[model samples]
Target: MSIEQRVTEEMKVAMRAKDKVRLIALKGIRAAFIEALKEDGSESLADDRATTILRRLAKQRRESIEAYEQGSRADLAALERAELEVIDAFLPSLADEETTRAWVEEAIASTGASSPGDMGRVMGALMSAHRGDLDGKLANRLVRELLGS
Candidate 1:
């Protein structure tokens, strides 16, 4: 099934199990999908688009966790962590290290990205090549390391 349908099903399971964190996260995800559909004037979201939205949600949770920890709010951080876990459940798995590394190398070669100045070019190529399956943050770090940045 599609990610969206899976998420809806999972939400029902979470509700039935009375898993508060998962239910909340799933609700937020559903809300996000609805908002996106309305904004884009689309009847349905592709799996890739849903994955992208989930990734963004996970990123937001990660940032919130970091900020809460920095502010000495362990309780909030823990909550964010729980939410992030739920968000991650819906995202597609990233490429393995070897696969990602190979892709990075290919992107660099294809983009002629010999220096950090070409980082954007390489990143664009990598994202297009991998679409929703690549971890963009990790790819960027790999690109920087490869380019000696």
Candidate 2:
């Protein structure tokens, strides 16, 4: 099933089970999907787009958790962490640092990225090929290190 469909089904399950955190997370995802569809003027979202949206939501949660923690709001941070767990359940596992390094090396070689100036080319290739799988920050660091920057 498409991610949206899966989320919808899960929402029903959450509602039935009275899972407040799961329901809230699912509702947030549903709202984001609806907003995306309205922006695109489309009736359905591709799985790729759905994954991107989920990733974005997860990222937001992570940032919020960090911010809350730094601001000394333990209760708020805990809530964000709970929401993050629910969001994470739908995300595919990320590639490890080692795997991301290998991909970065390959991208550098394939793109002839011999210097820091070629970081953009290498990153563009890497992200296009492994958007949802790899950690972008790790890949960027690898690219810079491999490029002797």
Candidate 3:
């Protein structure tokens, strides 16, 4: 099933099980998709767009969790962490360090990126190949390391 359909089915299951956390997370996903569709004047979101939305939501939850922890709000941090777990259920599996390194190597070679000046080209290629699978910040660090910059 498509991601949206899968999310809808999961939403139904959450409702049936009275899973409040899952239900809230699923609603947030649906709302994000709906907002993107409205913004783009599209009937449905492309898979990439859906993936991007989920990634953004997950990132937001991560940041919230960090902030809560920093502010000594364990309860809020726990809630954000729980929400992150639910949101992660829909995202693709991430690339491991080994795989990310391989992609960075290939991106550097493919783009002929020899220095930090070519970071953008290398990043564009790497993200196109592994968006959602690799964290951009980490990938950039790897690219810079590989490029000796």
Reference-based lDDT, each prediction: 0.90, 0.92, 0.89
- Which number leads on TM-score? 2
Off by over 4 Å in 2: none
Tens-place lDDT per residue, model 3, 1-149, is 77888888999999999999889989999999899989999887788789889999999999999999999999999988888998888898888888889999999999988888999999999988877789787788899898888
- Candidate order by decreasing lDDT: 2, 1, 3
Q: Is candidate 1 or candidate 2 better by TM-score?
A: 2
> For residues 1-149, could you state the per-residue lDDT of candidate 2 as single tens digits?
98889999999999999999889989999999999999999999998899899899999999999999999999999988898898888888999998998899889889987889999999999999998899888888889899999
In model 3, what are the clashing residue pairs, if there are any?
none
Clashes of each: 0, 0, 0
On lDDT, the candidate that comes out on top is: 2
Over the stretch 1-149, how does candidate 1's per-residue lDDT look in tens digits? Answer: 98889889999999999999889989999999999999999998888789889999998999999999999999999989999988888877889878899999999998888989999999999988798878787898999999999
The lowest-lDDT stretch of 10 consecutive residues in candidate 1 is: 128-137
